[model samples]
Target: MPRILAIDYGQKRTGIAVTDEMQIIASGLTTVPTHTLIDFLKNYFEKEKVEAVLIGEPKQMNGQPSQSASIIKGFATHFSNIFPEMKVVRVDERFTSKMAFQTMIDSGLNKKQRQNKALIDEISATILLQDYLRQK
Candidate 1:
């Protein structure tokens, strides 16, 4: 089976996660600058067999779309143009940052380590991927 990937997209950076070949284990892959996202994905896809890409959908508490929704949509459009064969899906990403921070604390990360926003994004992506696996 091919691996499924997940993205935690932010304004400045995007986190990436991928499942194993069997699509059972999800792991953090890396974080990249938003401007370099397409290039990064191009290189990654060139080397790996990805089944689909899962993007985070951040919505308001009242279920309205968040301000970042449009940004994600633009990225999705550009991504599809670049990799039309790869499937793209969106998963609800509310509270993922908070969950990542708590996970950092639970994992005994030092204060300095927890301060890395990039790490938080990567972990958030992992969490999103794990949630997706559970849903499947």
Candidate 2:
């Protein structure tokens, strides 16, 4: 079975996570610069069989799409055009960042370690993937 990939997209950086070939465990892959995300995904796809890519969809507490929705929409459109065979999924990502931060704290990470935005992004991506798996 091909694995599923998850993305936590940000303005400056994007976090990537992937499931095992069995699609059981979701693990953080890496964080790449936002500008380099497409290239990164292309390179990763060359080495791995990905069944789908989950893109985080940010929404407000009031059930409204967040401002970042436009950016994600544009990227998703371009991604589909580039890799028509790949499946694209949008998952609600409300409070993922806060949950990731709390996870870091619970893991006993130091303040400096907690300050790494890339790490937070990675954790967020992992959380997004795990949640998706649970729902599936």
Candidate 3:
């Protein structure tokens, strides 16, 4: 069975998450540099069977596209072109960062660990995947 993948795209780093083969549970996979995202995905897809890719869509409080939205959209386009057979979808990610922070706190992460931006990105991706699952 193929799994669902999620991405939390950022300027410097990108977070990756994946659901179980049955698509029942979402888990953080890794965080990679933005410049290396495509290569990372290429290697990952070669090893894992992915049914779809879900990317977090950032938006402002007024529901307008956030500054980072354009960049993410560009990446999404490139991703589609690279993996024509893979399905890609965008999901609203309004407060995922805040939610990630709270999750880390609840998980008992130390202050330093909580401050790790990569960790935050991974958690945000996990949250995004979980949200997508709920919506489905």
| Backbone clash count, each prediction separately | 0, 0, 0
How far in Å is the alpha carbon of 76 misplaced in model 2?
Answer: 1.0
Candidates in order, TM-scores: namely: 0.97, 0.98, 0.97
Model 2 C-alpha lDDT per residue in residues 3-109, reported as the tens digit of each score = 99999999899999999999999999999999999999999999999999999999999989999899988888988999899999999999999999999999999
Instruction: Please write out the lDDT profile of model 1 over residues 81-123, one tens digit for every residue.
Output: 8889989998999989999999999999999999999999999
Cα displacement (angstroms), candidate 2, residue 49, comes to 0.4
- Can you tell me which runs of candidate 1 are displaced by over 4 Å? none
Cα deviation in Å at residue 100, candidate 3?
Answer: 0.2
Per TM-score, the best of the predicted structures is 2
Taken over the whole model, the C-alpha lDDT of each candidate is: 0.93, 0.94, 0.95
